[model samples]
Target: MKELDKIDFRILKILQQNARIPMTELAEKVGLSSTPVTERVCRLEREHYISGYHAHLNPHLLGKPPLVFVELKLQSKSGNISKISKRSAENSANYGVPSGVGRIRLPD
Candidate 1:
């Protein structure tokens, strides 16, 4: 991978805090005109530096009840983790879990 310059780093930092930032506002924050800023963002996406955008959703607004997390301890380590993970993912997908709602890790 190539090194990111100051502009790219700044853009990334701002976007990290608020992915929904407007192009005009983002350009101003990074000290660039909208056109060049847009092109740079497009290039960033093409280079896979910015994989995709996401929105934080409100479950209640969506008519979804409170979310729950469960951790299961498998009794056997003999099973292939890949298959187990795939099955779990399939189950979640079938049950309408948003693809972007990824694994949540709690600090130990």
Candidate 2:
């Protein structure tokens, strides 16, 4: 991969700020036409600069109001993070957690 130029940096910064920005709007912001912007974006994707996009949801609307941070501590036990994440994602709906927490917090 070649060294990224100013245009490349601008494209990355803009996309990082708003992944959902339209191609035309993004081009306008970056001072380029949609065609070249699209090309650069495609090149960036091919080079693995952008991995994936996600949505931020309001937990309250999903019947889960409380938000809490959790820390996982491990002691000499090695586990696959991908497997853990997959299992948690599969069982999230049952526990009423959208995607962040591993457990549900019921009202007192």
Candidate 1: stretches off by over 4 Å: 72-108
Assess candidate 1 and give its lDDT: 0.74
Candidate 1, clashing residue pairs? none
Q: Clash pairs of candidate 2?
A: none
TM-score of each: 0.57, 0.59
The C-alpha stretches of model 2 lying farther than 4 A from their native spots are 71-108
Give lDDT: candidate 1, residue 26.
100
Over the stretch 3-73, how does candidate 2's per-residue lDDT look in tens digits?
78999999999999999999999999989999999999999988889888889897778877775444444
Give model 2's TM-score versus the native structure: 0.59
Candidate 1 lDDT over 21-67, as tens digits, reads 99999999999999999988888889999999998897767766555
How much does candidate 1 score in TM-score?
Answer: 0.57
